[model samples]
Target: MGELAPTVAFLTGAPTQGRIGVGWRTLRGLLGRPAETPTLTVAEVDTHLGDVATTSGSGSAARRSELLSHLLARATSAEQDFLLRLLTGELRQGALEGVMIEAIATATGVPGDLVRRAVMLSGGLAETAAAAASGGREALLAFRLELGRPVRPMLASPAESLDQAVEGIAEPIVEYKLDGARIQVHRDGDEVHVYTRTLREVTRQVAELADLVRGLPCASVVLDGETLALTDDGRPRPFQETMSRFGSTREEQVKALLLRPYFFDCLHLDGTDLLDASLRERREALHRVAGEHVIPGEVAPSDPAALLESSLDAGHEGVMVKDPDTPYAAGRRGRAWLKVKPSHTLDLVVLAAEWGHGRRTGYLSNLHLGARDPDGGEPIMVGKTFKGLTDELLEWQTRRFPELQRGSDDWTVHLRPELVVEIELDGVQTSTRYPGGVALRFARVLRYRPDKEAADADTIDAVTAMLRG
Candidate 1:
């Protein structure tokens, strides 16, 4: 417990990638032999984290870092890794980030709200609090403050259907799920900061938006909004096009794409926290602050059927049905917000596979998908997708995929097209990348279909019909 305190604190103050990377490295160093990797069961870690959270500011950043450094200086490599996992809040095999925060609160005996508020403002956990509770204030002063800490974007849980969202709210406002990027705008007097979904500083990427926001009606404010790239015809451009425009380093190329800022919620207006206010009140505040920058949309009746129809007519992904009674619940996936997208599934065959990068390294995880033929027996390759896979899935595939491997290398593993997988795709588009003359866009692995054989997968004709529809 003594050693664990400081490591967790240091990690809370470190950059997201740096904290995780350094923690992993420290863990490996402690373990001496890689085979003796230290593993902390979720139950065990969760218990201690909960204690730390409740322990009266014991999880503060300065204290946690001091405790971590003190402990790491004396720990075996394996012990260090074990401690690192606990501090970085990456202990579980299928854990959500929110769960980790809960464990931290439980460990320190600190209030979850205090921990969350500290983390959100500091952009990481405050290990110093934990240290102060354990090692005293002098120990906390040894740790330094790191700026621009990145935190995971707050996520929302999916609703069963549009009807589900309307049951709880009286008047629902339907917003387009723009196939664009999310931007968090923070303003302090004349200074402004723009952050991406992953909390990366993207101020330079959307300089035009920053200038426009500077002229906004508020003095000190924070806004949550979307930056969309619209086509010349006033339609939303393809997501890939928007990504390319943002990723482009050339000023001329970036300027060619027209980006519009659409404000959705006003988090802070003139030093008041509107997050706890109802959606109706927040909407009023957002409109007041945004003025012309507000998205050209209407607050519709709380009818799921009508909202769904309107969303389809607008060619948007789907309507976001939000609770009019709830306040802003950041970093928490509550029932207050729900996204209903019209999606379908297709069973496809594996054409090839690729090794994963970063945390997924050493696993043949990415899959190339193909559809079968109804008229003939041949399969046509459509597209490839790698997202939506869990660590358990990666490990399972790494072991099971060897039997299906046709060719192998450290970076890639070509398969024999023997396995079938069910995949969810947002839509299909004409593409020269695949032999079928079309490709599945935004394809995600829903599940591996062992109950059905490869021959039972969806046919190319079926996919073609879907594209036509």
Candidate 2:
């Protein structure tokens, strides 16, 4: 598996193919083949994993992948495959979280509910397990929300219809769903930080957003919301424009496209933690502090269709119907909140494309759609589709996508997640192969959304939400 890229590079006219353009190719050539003699031990392999985990500040991108690749080349083919999967975080062993929690309970003699709660609160199963096993029940109970640390954002399931969502929750608070990037603003005194949904610190990129948070009327606060770039007319710009600013490393470029934050839920305020607070409480706090910055929402809408219409007319994505009394359930797609949209379309990143067949030959036909990871990692592959392509699109993609190529094989060309495409899909289903555990069903390309970035793509939670509805 480590050789996949180096081999493709050689076949596809890569520069300095003999060296893999890094160190790994030479290391592999030196190792020759898996030896009959067992010189390397399991401990030696484990040591490499630990070393890679700790080593940092090494220069250049290719050097880093090659650094790990060189360590991996010493293993046998099967071991190399396992190591590759582990490195990519795609090692699916079919281990259930529920089962792991039960094992933690059995091993620690702590209550299962306590262990589960600690895992949810801490957002680290391994750490939770270690603490439970060593310190017992008290340690698990003591887990609390930290001030600067980001808690997993609560997720919502999709609603088949507004009526279905309203029916599920008697009275729903509907808020317009802005098409933008999720931002978690944390402020302590004058210190302000901004994070993406994946928990990546982007404070430096969105400095204007941090300044806005610093002006909030609270000593310390943690606000969960969305930020989007707006045009001169005060309308939200294309998602691509928003991401260009959000992901920009250059200060001047980011300054050119300032992001405006709309606070929705307040997780913490005035040195008091509100993570356990209900949506009603959070909304009240948000309104009290944010004032004009609070997202425009309607209470107990008499006409659901009318509300959805108003949201769409305002150029928003859709309406989110949330139960007021439900507590903030971090890291969970609970039934407490439901989202209703006009159509089942998602902004997905193009991970790769397969060569077309027959009349479509020489064109990039099939597309691999990926959703954003909440924990700030690589986009996870959900599924592939070749439907809904015009001849113009096929020709354009054939000529265009190779410019963004990362790696390639005979049948497929892997790409960096630079291009975002709008996709219409039936829904999602459970899948063992995809890291998201759900795959798009009947997915078809709508068009390439040049205005959106990979960071603006819909999340894996959004895909999984379709499974419930």
Candidate 3:
């Protein structure tokens, strides 16, 4: 999944299925070779042996030499080329682990669910495949949750509106949509481990959080929640501050801005696994065990708008309307949970201006926008936009952008970041390309905010909070 763009592009453009196949026929056409030698066997390619007939492992280097000699001795020029690509990691078959699980299940006569379950628990496809083939269904199902191993967290899908979110659910749990990081806490005896949404362990970095979890009554438990930095008044800090603290490893920095966890679901309590249980059941278990840390939420409300207002008043992003009967389906962004946040406009700094294209050529277009950093640092880029710009605005920017130029690249004119512009966007999405870990979606310029300075620009935290919507 983390493959480089060029590699992924090459693989995507390669012929993988139907019509054009990567066989010896194609190999002969490409390399102008014939199979003058014997076909390479699985044993020869999988492991090194002196020869097909020879099997001796007396010397480590000698054994490897023998294996390579035996394998290459049988391989044709085209076959050797294929081997080189495989060894160099250039032969991307364009298949994920999901495909391999299906193949294993089909080959071993095991159910796909059993194979998946084994893979999830074992955390390795090769290991899971071996177990399924050798020990069958019983062995696959035996794979259970370990204390430190992280399971995939459940995700939520975006909803159009609050009414659309709670349309079908009988008793939706309206929980405050905290503008924070998703945290998965696993408490096994005295050891407490914390994981991010991506399942990266930050046990040492969030030591205080672990200490708080240690106070919980249960000896072993797995809780899903959100963590945020809070002020002395007990209000949640901006997401930027929360992330800055969350990502810190220094002792003093971590202590300076401690994060508070607001748990909402319990996947495991004591020895019982409640992954297959309903949301209502999980919430009940969570309240019983960590009631003090449970996030503020209520059953189906008659006045959701009022609840939403209260949420905003408390400095929360919005409200999450969740179905009470749905099972915890990890790794899936389903409709069971829906977040609702009112749309708002922001005044952002123009970092740069990009040259236009086609109808907009020769004019300064695609304004690069950035949000303010709370630490009095440089503006962090959120996104760029060329939309909602009239010809007059384009002409004005073309003449004005150069005056505010700090530098200029081939296609972009870097600005002084002194110009503040108002932007209206649908929301923000999690992004790796941007410095703020978020990017604006469907952003359009409302107007230039000449009244406000770059110092008065909205923060990265405010932009990130739109992710809840």
Candidate 4:
């Protein structure tokens, strides 16, 4: 009951056996096992669900199809309908699983916060719910930061100015915020895994970085940091250059565009979980095992503005002002950490795009941008721009956006709200043109946020807040 395999099955919707692809329509047409056979039990169905995740061979897909057909065949009609819904990702047992935390707390009499924290650290609501229901609060609270399973990362709220960023935070720790991809590294002996800010494992793509962490002086540790490709002079390459390395596993491709790691915070060290420790304590732990590998920063500097200039002069993005007294707030964004970039940027979703003209002919040029709706609704359009697309980017968009297209016209291609892009703008202005009653001023594309999804885009609330002052 605690296993996440079934949940994973529910989420992925289908197995990796693309060759023997099975969809609802295909399954509906196929015959199942004999009707006289004994009905499938819950435990037997669980076994099949677990095996579907890792069962791969030259002929494994057909075997998996048989298992699913048999499970459905022996089930009651109602149960069969439920299984089909789960396979199609339409089973909303709770609104996308977050509601399950509250349900578990209510049923088990354990705290909802306890269940949520356990889920965040363990990355499995099923396991946490089982523990809570079986052994109550003590077992629910027993979940620790697992080494390999990626925990949801803490995020930062964007600040309007440097003073505003550090206004209420105490004993600020100013670290150079380099323009790079965020990474979470887990090291256990010689085995190491590297995950992106979204918690997707990229260890296979960046195995060299994993090897570097394996050499660090720690038996088991988890470090939060950033990685980027640097020039021969040791300056960061463009953000696009760094991101281009995340999807490849080729030896020549990986080796040619090598990435370097810069650790900032330690979440675990030497068998102790540091998730509850202060940033100062965690930074010390980070320095102990990764002195040379730590990100460059100072604790409560007298001249934080000067440091910001130095960061910019050195070709970095800006400085991150952090509160040294704060603990690692996993999976939440609060005032403890603030990013101060030179210009304003918002992560917006691409609602659609218009075909190009003139020199931009044959490419998708102008993009329609939309801010996320916090009420679980579709994205609300704020503005459109073709101001920042380079030749390479235009070509990439023309190729990429079509794959995600939902519907299109002669000039504009409407798409599913899938690609999140970074946008830099002067400010927001009141406007009736958009549903949010606010529009971005002089907006230009900064970069595409491949690491983010539509849900993670800056909310309409965040965008409208800029119009306040």
Candidate 5:
């Protein structure tokens, strides 16, 4: 049990791919060795009942404290850490939730696809299937689960360009790439609760939202939506500012953020599980119950060029090309839905570098890039990105970046501005952090450009022009 601490530490401190592999490997070892276990099914774990022993609020504080103290005393430090990680859902050590489903399937002698489907439709965990397989159908079906919790809908890795998605999907619905937090709204009777993807209850955190949702015309409902902090002119506020409000301790400050909810889909309404329905049906349901507060919209067309033009004109992320007839596939990175975003590349100078973690721990990984000021002749930081680096590229950076290093640390190697890289960015936003009072959004490395000098990089004027035009 004590040996599991390193794995827990690995998961909690650095949930990178490498660390997750280590954690899963550790779990695999544990699963291989039999021991006394709880009778709860994998569904129970998915429903987050595994941690109820610690989080249950029935006992007095002192009594609960004593129980916790005794429990901690019997366990090794490693076991304690592992338990904490499991309870908190911070088991980040790089193993994806999908891999865990595979492991559970293997352990239970159930087909991985069956287990995956059950988990997806039920919005439970791999452990639920494991329990069902181990404990039988009765054990798995005992737990009551509700709909509307936005299960991790299948996602695609970012495409090369908006045109790629257009070419792939026949029809696309371009929606706003809102700078906001994703929320799953569940309404039972008049009571409404908002839960993050991790199942954290944020009901109290957004009281006004709860109030607004109470007015939604439905006896029972589950909806997927984004909550954005809006500016006076009706544009989204900064992402960091939105996150700050999310993490704010003051209730008043949170309410002051002026979160506006935008419903994207209707997952459940009037006791129906719409997960099996088509996107068109879901959209129809959304429009029916959403009312005035919910932004009314739908899929535009099957043509890529038309979709792209409409999305850009509407000031949205390029477009999300979804399969109209496909069933909702959750917690899987399937091709049922695709996103298209306009590619805006800039030749930017590397302003600073940060140390990598997990797999690339020994290398300088994340690079902060900047564009030359239009008037001041100084470099203004636009964005920071670590994506798009291959392992070979990482090794090359580790070896070459140090040659220009101004300072060194275990994690990062700071270097003077010398390298020029062509970067792809999603869009621009007004920011207080950058010297130019603006920043780039969703910036990614395209490639290092030896042909372009720092002097030849895109200037702030060009960036501003892109934003304007």
Candidate 6:
């Protein structure tokens, strides 16, 4: 979901990504306890949540800052730590979304599926929880696919090869997997709204796209698709070029990077919802409504290899092989859709590591990967992954990294950037999360490179080049 929630910024102007507007040393001074600490109750903290949690508060910036100072001044050491982690979105007590859904079901005596489905449609866990508490199952069941409101798009799981992707499916619906931005566009007559895969509305930023969708033949429709900037030859431009338009309102930039939509699935059309419909039925509706805008593919191809080859030749990332009989499962990675691509590998340096929990307790599990700076500066971090490590590898790292440790914090162990490991990734994409302005996509550890030095690692330019691959 890194593509969805790229960064977390708080209403207090504090951030876990981008620049640090407030100095940490200045804030740390507030965490220090007074000679005699005063009692700060949970009731006092609850009263401040509404004022500071929203950006539209009527209070002045200085007034809000003063409130925060008083709150932190009376907080116990543990309470201060909890507040910092909660605000920064670093609080992890093992209560995942699924766990909370199950808890709500248990408390309200509503079926878990009903609560989950309501959450998927409403896009708010807090709202669903309130509904379940007030009216039980009836309130949850009342939620439906609303026009102009975007639902969570279904995701594709990765496959090693085309053969593996189509192994058991009888008649697969395979389409070109473009390396572009995923958009879920909803049209209600002349008012068309477009949303990112994360369900954020960007219709204003992509006004031209709105115009195109508004012109579609249907009255009310929901289309799931990919949109990317294309060259004059109709070949896909670099992914960065496509992603740039989503974050900006600059007229010239929007004009320069025009995105073309290629829809693959239709979830709703006219007056009917297709949430429980099979792909065979939905695909037919998609062709009837989208016409030329429907993504090109075949059902039960004689040579899927050639289909994948054609996708690559046309400057796309790969192909998505999907099951034709399965219903759309929103917000989850069902077994129906799978992505296949050529294997990509890179030798990256380990910049830092995070301590693991659960079965991986007492060891560093997630790795912070980086690429070499060609100009002889510090290494630029690309991404992190603990995907392909074995238990033995975890033990080795836990024992070995302490020797190369440079510093430590509550979350991550900083290293000297001397160790290099080979990584296998799906590809690289333009990202604002790292210093290099790029991040590795779907990366996993391959093996440690004992013979390689930090100088032998791949450069940032080479990593960015994979955006085209």
Q: List, residue by residue over 1-469, the lDDT tens digit for candidate 2.
A: 2333222222222211111222323333334354343455544554554454445564644455655666655667665644444332232211134456677788779998788777666755566776776689998988987767676677667678888888866668888888888888888999988878756678888888888888888898888888888888878887767877755779788767878888789988887778778888888888888888888787788887888888798788888888988877654446688888888988788999999999998999899888876554678889999999999889989998786666899999988666789898888899998777888888998778654456557778778878885
Best by TM-score: 4
Residue-wise C-alpha lDDT for candidate 5, range 1-469, written one tens digit per residue:
2223223223322211121212222332233222234343323222232232344445544453444444444445555555445432234222234455666567666667666666655554533543555564454444333754445444433444556554555555545444356777888888888866444567877877887778887888888877778888776675446555555448779757878888877888888978778877887898899866555334655555665676566554455656666666664245566655676667788877788889888777899788865342446787788998878778888788775555666656665555778788777888888776678888888777653345446667667655653
Model 3 whole-model lDDT (C-alpha atoms): 0.73
For candidate 3, lDDT tens digit of each residue in 67-118? 4444555688776675434332223222234456677799889998778666
**Candidate lDDT (C-alpha), each:** 0.63, 0.72, 0.73, 0.80, 0.60, 0.76
- Write the residue-wise lDDT of candidate 1 on 156-242 in tens digits: 444546776556566667676655677788877778778776566777777777788888887877788777788777778755566
User: Could you list the CA RMSD of all candidates, in the order they appear?
Assistant: 13.5, 8.2, 14.3, 5.0, 14.1, 12.6
lDDT of 1: 0.63
**Candidates 4 and 6 compared by lDDT, better number:** 4
Candidate achieving higher TM-score, 1 or 2: 2
What is the model-wide C-alpha lDDT for candidate 2? 0.72
lDDT (0-100) at residue 429 of candidate 3?
89
TM-score of each: 0.58, 0.73, 0.58, 0.82, 0.58, 0.69
lDDT of 6 by residue, 1-469 (tens): 1211111112111222322222333345456563255476444555554444442445555555566677777787777876655443233211245556687799899999888888788765666776788789999989999998888668776565689789999999889998788899998878789998767788988988898888888898999999989999999997657877888888898888888999999999998999789999999999988999888799999999999999999999789999999877764345699887787778788989899988988998899998877655568899999999999889999998876666889878988666889899888899999988898999998778653456557778768877776
lDDT of 4 by residue, 132-243 (tens): 7678888967888888988877878888888887787667889999899999999988889999987789999998889999898889999999999999999899998899
Q: Which pairs of residues collide in candidate 3?
A: 49-67
In model 2, how large is the Cα lDDT of residue 47? 52
Local error of candidate 2 at 441, Å? 7.9
Candidate 1 worst ten-residue window by lDDT? 89-98
Quick one: best lDDT, which candidate? 4
